[model samples]
Target: MRSKVSIQKLTMSYYLKDRVVTALNGIDLEIADGEFLVVVGLSGCGKTTLLNILAGFIKPTGGEILLDGKPIAQAGLMNRGVVFQEYALFPWRTALQNVEFGLEMKGVDRKNRREIALKYLDLVHLTNFTNIYPHHLSGGMKQRVAVARAYAYEPEFMLMDEPFGALDAQTRESLQALTVEVWQKTRKTIFYVTHNIGEAVYLADRIIVLAGQPGRIYKEIRVDLPRPRDSFDPRYVELERETTRAVRQG
Candidate 1:
């Protein structure tokens, strides 16, 4: 598979108050172009730190991250888009404005940005609430808006940090289905960090399990449950159980 993003001996540490605490220890990962890779681990397992480094949101203490064979020097709009665990929608901006914000930053004119934003909103089935404020939207609706915002940006890769972690089970399932549809349609490479074993099994092309105090990749499992998966299927349950054990025992 072609690598869209590659990490070489990636390491991260925080020198907080002159104490060196390693967050990532000699890690390497490659996310293929148009692949959906889900990562599962216990809390504080450095999954979020890994995504942050890939996004250039946090500089790694050691090693490097490359996007499309080039070094990721800094945060740039062209590089990637991130969906937060918490829907980081701007409260003051309506759904449409929030989606258009990225285009505006890219210097796309008002006429074009609005057109693109609405198109994304429609794609996420949120066209009816384009004018709604973040506060007026439910948790699931807010997350859908955030997903639309990322799509509107037309990023080459997406880093999702448990985008559906805060939602109810039903909402999470719907969003997972919606995300798979978008991923198939756009072929955007995604590195999603989550703790949900079933969600990882249902969404990922491959699942990476991280373990240890300073997280390291424990196992890489290719999910062969097939697309449009049914969680009730025996194959799905089997893979989920295997992954869960790898994570717990790693």
Candidate 2:
């Protein structure tokens, strides 16, 4: 697969009162087109920081990110979509309207945008809840709406930061499967950050472990297990153990 995004010698730091704290140092990575890549580490490892830089939410103090060989800062385009742990849905808007938000921003006509929004809602199995408001939806339902909203705009890269972290165990597992299903269909390059080893094992085509406190890549592990991945399978169990050990040791 072609490299869709590239990171070279990335570094980030910020002042916390009188001290300048480094969040990431000399980090480098490449995400392939249509690949599911997950970043895992202990807290303070800069996983979210890296994802934010890729989403164009923050500029790294040093180095640069490239989208298809062009500097992301110079690209002048909204080519990345992001999903967060919190269901960042509009409380006032119904599910359908919320999904329509990005399309509306893109200057899509009302009728056409509605059609596109509905299609994405259906993709996320939220067609039945189209008119439901965020306040009325359960946590999982709210996240499904968020996922639909992100996909509706057809972005080249999807940046996810612990999107399933807030949910119950069963709900998290359900959404994990839903995420893979959506990815298989859309084939969008996904840059996901999580501390959950099982989640990383299940979702990632490749996993990069970051060491904490001035985060740097400590290890890279590729998952060779077949999908519809069985977590209970021995190979799956072994890989999960290996990843857990890497995270602990890193």
Candidate 3:
């Protein structure tokens, strides 16, 4: 697998009040093309910061991120799609319309974008709810729409920041499965940040734990288990325990 996204000696800092605060320091990582990479850590671990940099929402104070050997900043917003913990869907738009928003921004024709949007909504198993508004949908349904929206434009990378954090246990698990299904089908390189160890173990090809007080990668673990992982399986349980211990130690 070739490296699709590379973080080289990355650093970020800022001032709060009268003192300087470093959010990240000396970080280096490489994400392979179509790899599902999850970042786990405690609060203030710069996980969101790192994702923000990749999304081009913020520039790192030092170092750089490379996408396909080119500066990630140059990749443009169209190449990197982000899904937030909050289902940032438009209240005014129906599920299909929300999914079409990105394509519309990209100048895709109305009829083509609508067809594309419906296809992705169907991909998320929301074919029957395409005309529903966000406020009318359940939390999980809204999130499904958000995911569909992000993928509709066919971005090379998907940056997810705790997208399932707000859902209940059952909903979260279902969304996790849905996410894996989407990843397997689309093969999009994904960077998912979450505090849930089980979620990380279930979804990641690899996991990186970040430590705080100037966050940096503390440990990297690869999940060798087969797909559609069973949480009750002994190996799965042990791996989850191991990842939890790593996060605690971090």
- Put the candidates in lDDT order, highest first: 3, 2, 1
Per-residue lDDT of model 1, residues 81-135, tens digit only: 8999788899999999999999998889999999999999998899899999999
Per-model TM-score, in order, reads 0.96, 0.98, 0.98
Residue range with the least summed lDDT across 10 consecutive positions in model 3:
68-77
RMSD of each: 1.2, 1.0, 0.8
Among the numbered candidates, top TM-score falls to 3
Better of 1 and 3 by lDDT: 3
TM-score, cand. 1 vs. native? 0.96
**Local accuracy of candidate 2 as per-residue lDDT tens digits, 1-250:** 6589989999999878899989999998988989999999999999988988888888899997889889998765458889999998988999999999999988999999999999999999998999999999999999999999999999988999999999999999999999999999999999999999999999999999999889999999999998899999998999899899999999
How well does model 3 score by local distance difference test? 0.94
Looking at model 1, residue 169 earns an lDDT score of 95
- Name the lDDT value of residue 116 in candidate 3: 95
- Among the numbered candidates, top lDDT falls to 3
On the 0 to 100 scale, the lDDT of residue 241 in model 2 is 92
Worst 10 residues of 2 by lDDT: 72-81
